[model samples]
Target: MPAVFILLRSLVIRLLSSRLAGSVAQFLRRTISTGAAHIGTALRHVWERIRSQESKEAVLGCVLCILNMHKKVET
Candidate 1:
């Protein structure tokens, strides 16, 4: 999935920069910043801490709590 993002980002930059000005380079500086739909490696993250193990555990805990399945999830 990360590979796919890299390929798509590269392709977008290639095509846009070819027909546009250097302003197209701004695309690289853009980031997703928020939202679950675009979570993971498909987009650039502002920081690794945003998806850290602690955060993952928190999310899993919330999901389990919501579903009333607060049981051990074996890793």
Candidate 2:
């Protein structure tokens, strides 16, 4: 019936808008923070490698590795 259809639509809207649907902000914050922490650690490791007494070729290689990881373009 039309009335049943309207009731179902309203119920779906209410459920989607309610707090029981869960916090999108919380999910975003958690995902971003976790991803940022990983990137921070990776950068730290690369920085330490640069600061160490490694050869110039090795340091350049590390940086090149990072760039290539994202895009495989001819150097």
Candidate 3:
């Protein structure tokens, strides 16, 4: 009876730990994807501005502002 209780306890612990780890991994993956999307969008906007022959200084300023905003959001 003692051995059976120990086995059951161990099994429950293992299951719980595995579930916690999976949840953490999923959260990190989602966070990374969101950050990547923000950067990609910023870059695309900058590129479009350049292609449109917009002022270089203005484009640079916009990109910098976007980066600053991203940094703030991440923190």
Candidate 4:
């Protein structure tokens, strides 16, 4: 999850500073920030669920999911 966030943030920064300009750049910034905020909220909910889950296997699965998130996004 952290890796995914880093990848997304880097992409957004690169796009905002390079290929985007004027109102389009501002729009993209706002859109990406809003989307990131929403994802953060969702992640908090997921964290809560993971904490409440007592099964070791379930927790491990969640960890694995996060670790592999970047790979999934790449493809």
On TM-score, the candidate that comes out on top is 3
lDDT per model vs. reference = 0.64, 0.79, 0.85, 0.78
Better of 1 and 4 by lDDT: 4
Q: Tens-digit lDDT track for model 2 on 1-75?
A: 999999999999998887554788778889999998998788677767665566656766876788589875688
* Candidate 1 TM-score versus the reference: 0.27
Off by over 4 Å in 2: 1-22, 52-75
Winning model by lDDT: 3
lDDT of 1 at 61: 79
Q: What's each prediction's clash count? A: 0, 0, 0, 0
> Which of the two candidates, 2 or 3, achieves a greater TM-score against the reference?
3
Q: Which model is ahead, 3 or 4, in terms of TM-score?
A: 3
Query: Model 1, 1-75: lDDT tens per residue?
Result: 999999999999998878676555455334434343465444234334456888767766765587687666889
Tens digits of lDDT, candidate 4, 1-75: 999999999999988877656768789899999998997788667776764456656766886788688784545
Q: Which pairs clash (backbone N, Cα, C closer than 3 Å) in model 4?
A: none
Clashing pairs in 3: none
Q: After superposition, how far is residue 69 of candidate 2 from its true place, in Å?
A: 18
TM-score of 2: 0.44
